[model samples]
Every structure is written in C-alpha cells, then in structure tokens.
Target: MTWGDGDGFVTCELGHKHWGRYGAAGLLPYHDGYVLLQHRAKVTIGGGTWGAFGGARRRGEDPVAAALRETAEESTLDASEVTLRGLMHEDHGGWSYDTVIATAPALLEVRPASWESKGAAWVPVDEVAEHNLFEPFAKAWPRLRQALRRPVLVVDGANVMGSRADGWWRDRAGASARLRDQLGAVDRYTGIAPFDVAIPEKVLVVEGKARNIGPGDTDVRVVSAEADGDDKIVETAASIVAEGPDVLCLVVTADRELRRRCVAVGAEVTGPRWLLNQIAPKAVDTPG
Candidate 1:
C-alpha cells in the first residue's frame, strides 16, 4: 500500500484514535430510495462491515474533494456523475470527519476497484439498518437518513427585484437577468437558516416584462411566467415538492400572500433579503 502524509493513526483531543492526521471524509451517493455502500475487506479497519466508500484525506485537501477522491479510488463510480447535495460534519475535538452527501441521476453500476473493499452494493434505505454496519456509520445513519434530501432554492424574481432599490423599475428583464447571473456566481452561502449548508438547486421565476429574459450562463433554472408571477411560483413549488419526499423546497419571497400560498404546498418560506445577502458583497438593510 502507498502511504500518504495523512495515512496514520493519531489520538485526538477526545482521546480516541483516528486514521487520518489531517481529517477524513466519506461519500454517500443516494438515488431512487437507495444508497451505495462498500463492504470492507477483512484486512481493513471495520473489516467485513458495510460503510461509505472513503479513506483518510490528503493534506490540505477540501473535505468534498477528499470524499470524491477516496470514493473513486475504492469503486468504479466517478465523481463527475453525481450532484453534490450538502455536507454533514462530525467533530472529534482535534480530528473531524465530513460526510459528503450527493445524488445520482440513476443507480449507476459500481464495483470494488481496490483491495480495501470486499464488495460494493446499492442498498435500499429501509434495509440499511439490517446490515452489519461499521460502528461510527451505524450511529450516524439515522441523522444522515433524515438529511438525504437536497435543498432547492426557488427565487421569486419580480418580488426580489422590487425589494432592491437599485433602479430595477426601468427594465424588469435586465434586473431578472442580473439576479440570475449573481445566483450563479455564489460558491457558498451564509445565513441559510433552514440547512447547514447551501449548495442548492436554484430556480428563478420571472414574469411579465421579465419573462423574456434569456437563461443566463449559469446553473440556475429560469422559469418564465405567462401571467401572474405569484401563481407560477406556487405552481413551481408544488411541482418540485411532488417530485419526491426527499426534496426540501425553500421559496425566497417577501410577499405575505405568496408565502402563505407556498407554505400550503409544503415549502418553507424565507425572505428575498437572505437571497440578496448571499449573492452580493454588500449587505441588504431593507426588510424582506
């Protein structure tokens, strides 16, 4: 086995020995009510037990990047095929472990590509507890199960544009396009109250004059409304919630009526100011 800088056991402040000197991370890829897990080889730690495909992180590597690299080394699956959802961190005083959550479009075939794994399988979520699980993974499974779903941020373009006093009344389409572009450039977010992290599936709903705005060169999905913007927003939230139980929809709008309407369809409501604060450098003092 090739040894890396982080590949040794170290006792943490909690007085527990961990495998990595820097830290460790694991990948949890879910799809269609199932999760991909690895069966550890007899010679490895937690041998013969099921756990995430992972290992010690390389020095100074980002947790997400480490998780992806470890998973790719241990299995046939590649990181590019999956969409990163969010992250769950477990701090052991001086040491830490990050569980990187992701979603696959389909149940892609994966097999053990390294000696560390005895096998790999896509196990149904309901049946996970039935397996002989690794100790730490077993303890974290319940919380991780509850957090499997990804957050989808639905932005009400007209409502949010109105909130900003940046002279958006002149050209609504230009304002909408600007919003879309800003949402794309965000690498991370702060003050996302509902979730621990904010890597989300962004949807911007534009209406009336703003409906003609082109889809910008970002990952944000722009939904144009034919008539009433509020109606379209409600419809969009309902359709997304219906997609699966794992989806967590958070609508960004200050419209009281619209907030109540979105809540009726099972979406959590936040304000436009929170969205603006995340994408822009300057803080918004206006009320959402």
Candidate 2:
C-alpha cells in the first residue's frame, strides 16, 4: 500500500506484539553539533522524556511528509528548513510506525506549543544521555549519535536522468556529463545545501557514457566502472558499512531494484525529487 493508504499497520514479532499503530517522523535539529529535543509533557504518553519532535502520520500522507508536517505544527519550525537524512527505524507489530530522521540547519529555539509536548530545547550530543528519554528513543540514541556524525548522499545518475524532463534522452551522454558537472559544482558550494554539520562525503555513481568521471577536489567523489553504476553504488555502500557503525549513507535512485540492494546493506534510499528539490541554482551555471 502507499504511505498513507489503508489503516497502515505492520506486525513486529519482537515480543508482546506491542501496538504503536502510527507512523512518525522525527526532526534531529542540529547546529554546531547540538541537537534539538523535546521533553514530553506530564500529560502525554511517554511524557517527561526526551525525544525528537514527531507524531502520528495523517491518512494519505507519507511518513516523512507527516513527520515534517507534525514538527512544524508542534514547534513552528518550517518544514523547508529541514533536510531529510534517512529512516532510523521501523517498529511494526500488530501496529506499525516508521521513524523518519531528518536534519535541521540550526539548533532552533523550539517551544512546546502543542498539547503533545511539555517542553523543548537544544541538547548536545554528548549530553543526550543525561535526559530522561522514551524507551525506544533511548534505545536508538546510540545509533543516532553515530549517524549524526556522518551524513552521505548517493546519486544514481542514470535513474535520475530518466526522472528529469529536461530532454535528456535526446542526448544521454551530454545530459549525464552536465549532471556530473552540476553535482561537482554543488559539492563545492559549501553554503548552498546548508547543513547543521559539515558533510563528510558525497558519492556519485555513473554508468555507460558517464563512466569516466573522476573525483574532484570538492566533497564529492565520482566512481565510474564497467559494472552497472547501481552495482558500484552497492559495493561502495558495503565498503562504507565495513568501516563500522558511525557512518550514515543514503542512496539516491528511482530504481526499485537498486533501492532493494542498497537497503540490504543498510543504506538509506530516496527518490530523485528529494535531490532535485534541494538543488541550488547557484551551484551550477547553465545556458539560459
């Protein structure tokens, strides 16, 4: 079923078959290494505990969309101010909930204006352990801590090319070449894609005519190979996974099969729109 269609519940056999019955999106607003967290109000479920700003998904909405919407409603933080990082978890059982973790550019001054939250404040990553946290959040904190340190964006040049209506098919090679150049330029525009923390890495995989592009001095590294770019992406992702648990890798592609492959190795997947929407005009110079 689609994100918001149906009752939206999945069964998790993790025991007791706990029923959360809701999908959620959490904003891990960060600025200069600090994260924004909320202290649940005494009246709310899991109240008086620390957690990211989030809530139940509305019917007919995607979990990520719902999460961003809830964050704005609860804290008055603009949804456009945040950049989706990836999914942190999916808790399902008789009931189901998807955790969409996004990053914000600053340690926003968030207040608990909504009935669901009692208080909200910015908390340093090192200090998160000091707060009384919701059980699930507490359990996920360690992993989140690691993820916050390294954020990655993977591009499937071919799939993205198909998604763009810019007349790319007429000149596949030229389109891919231009895309590579644009991405390279983007990597150098430090403030264009604004992030709470410095992005450690960006990987772009190109196939066919685009296979010869190489890494530049910018934050992006281009990998072109004889094998399918999708395979190369998965391989690179697997290599990153081997570096330990502190890395956050996101795969960008509209290919379903590629998405499944990335997920198998713990990489997060997002469609081309997510990337295109974030593209800044200042990053690339084009013919008018």
Give the top-scoring candidate (lDDT). 1
- Compared with the true structure, what per-residue lDDT tens digits does model 1 show for residues 55-135? 888899998888998898889998899998887778898788888889998999999999999999999999999999988
- Point out where model 2 deviates above 4 Å: 1-12, 15-20, 153-172, 175-288
lDDT string for model 2 (141-206, tens) is 876675564566778888877777777778877777667666656431122122222333577788
- Summed over model 2, clashes come to 5
- The CA lDDT at 248 in model 1 is 87
Q: Per the 3 Å backbone cut-off, how many clashing residue pairs does candidate 1 have?
A: 0
Give me the candidate number with maximum TM-score.
1
